[model samples]
Target: MTRESEALSLRVRRVLHAPRAVVFRALIDPDELARWWGPEGFTIPGVERDLRPGGSFRITMRPPDGEAFHLVGEYRLVEPPERLSYTFRWEEPDPEDRETVVDLALRDLPGVGCELHLEQGSFATPSRLALHEEGWSQSLDKLDRLLTAEGRA
Candidate 1:
């Protein structure tokens, strides 16, 4: 088994028109993931999800430059529509470091919308944190578009 590692995380607020359950389902459901899985222009060619603990959730992200980054990780915690904490490690990380933890949470806002929060911690340096901040921010924007397109918002 791979060792537990650290990552720098961020907390974000996303108001989706759908209920917390619906938003959470979109995140955990593999079939629904393809629609909004990458940062802005990047594409997701493959995705595999396991909804239970110890299951593997893997995705292949294809950037516009044709670079493919395979994100392979295991599910550490899973509570539908409420919380999900996972171990996110790149398949081909820099030889020096190879792992990080990403924790995601969902909260219902009583007829308003769902709040999606994320915490990605344990990064070794501030640069890595900054890099991920950009990536996740872009990805969240894409998710907004996807949810809107799906008529969930």
Candidate 2:
């Protein structure tokens, strides 16, 4: 994993041992997304998605020891096996929370697999940026494990 952070934005890069198409599918497919979409110990109880530009998605996330919460977003761009972008906002946001844009770019690695570049921006504060950084790091770790376990890695 490689991470780059600015005061109000973040970038994370990970090399996945799975093909680009598979990783791209995992991002937009509700079933596959629910299986590995959150930080460690977090589970997804519900996922509703339209999977197209201008469409929307709502994901219910259950923490290890708290009430479930939701994250809602609208798709901005969705190009299969290559790129995706969306607007992300918490349904019930913290005072510091603000809607942000998340962009994902997937590059094929030939014989190896694929590289995923994730960028999210314009946080209200550095603390908010830090929080998202941790969440995304753990979530990507979980995704890697999922793909490996399924023998796609």
Candidate 3:
């Protein structure tokens, strides 16, 4: 089997309604991330970020039905308004699941807009990959709304 088929990765790009710095903070800062860090209808009751290489973060994502889930990761590389890369893994992981890398690149497009490129994973199953894609998409949507409301658009 091809390498991709063996361990697939998901990639997506989106333009946000904010400047690069704003978008960058939304991804790194605990409060900013809590504002727009999960799927629709999800709330974050707990968030911690150490914000440096080798530093770790943990976020509690509580869904509408309660039973919060935790997302934990460590910073691999962090560059303001430019690039950030980290290792991501759910707190309660699947038996076959492995830690995955998430790389984000932000490009400042003039007129107070930024482009975000997100690449994540090498999942053992398609369902796992799909789950992340859907979650990330929704989170990005919220981020866009948050930034727009901040008048940064």
Candidate 4:
């Protein structure tokens, strides 16, 4: 994995040990997403998605110990097995929270697997960026493990 950061944005790259199609499906399939969508110890109790441009999704996240919260988003672009872009915002935002855009690109690596590039941006502050960085880091780690356990690795 590799990461690049700016004051209000972040980029994360990961090489998943799975085919591009497999990884891409996991991203858009609500059932697959619920299996590995959050940071360590976080569980997704509910996931609702309409997978298409202009479609929206809402996910309920239950932390290790706390009331569940929600994050909602609307799809801006959805290109299967390649790209997806969406607007992301917390249902109940912090003082520094603001809606942001998330873009994902999946590239196939012949004879190997796939590479995922994730970019999210225009945060209200560096601290918010850091928080998302950590979350994505852990979430991606979970994704890797899931693919591996499923024998896609």
Instruction: Please count the clashing residue pairs in each candidate, in the order shown.
Output: 10, 0, 0, 0
Could you say which candidate leads in lDDT?
Answer: 2
lDDT of 3 by residue, 43-151 (tens): 9998998989999999999998979888899999999979999999989998867789899999988985999999888887888898899999999999999899889
Write down the lDDT that model 4 would get.
0.92
Query: What 10-residue stretch in candidate 2 is worst by lDDT?
Result: 1-10
Whole-model lDDT for model 2 versus the true structure? 0.93
Which ten-residue region of model 1 has the weakest summed lDDT? Answer: 1-10
Q: What's the distance in Å from true for residue 114, model 4?
A: 0.6
TM-score of 2: 0.95
Candidate 1 per-residue lDDT over residues 1-153, each given as its tens digit = 223333344456677667788788878887677777777788888898876899998899998898888999999999987998888888888653447777888888887778888887667666777777888888777777777777775
Candidate 2: residue 82 lDDT (0-100): 99
> How would you encode candidate 4's per-residue C-alpha lDDT over 1-153 as one tens digit per residue?
223335578889999989999999999898899999889999999999999999999999999999999999999999998999999999999999999999999999897789999999878888999999999999999998999988996
Q: Write the per-residue lDDT of candidate 2 for residues 52-120, one digit (tens) a residue.
A: 999999999999999999999999999998999999999999999989999999999988789999999
Candidates arranged by lDDT, highest first: 2, 4, 3, 1
After TM-score superposition, the amount by which residue 92's alpha carbon in candidate 4 deviates from its true location, in angstroms, is 0.3
- Which residue pairs of candidate 2 clash? none
Give the higher-TM-score candidate: 1 or 3: 3
RMSD of 3: 1.8
lDDT of 1 at 58: 87
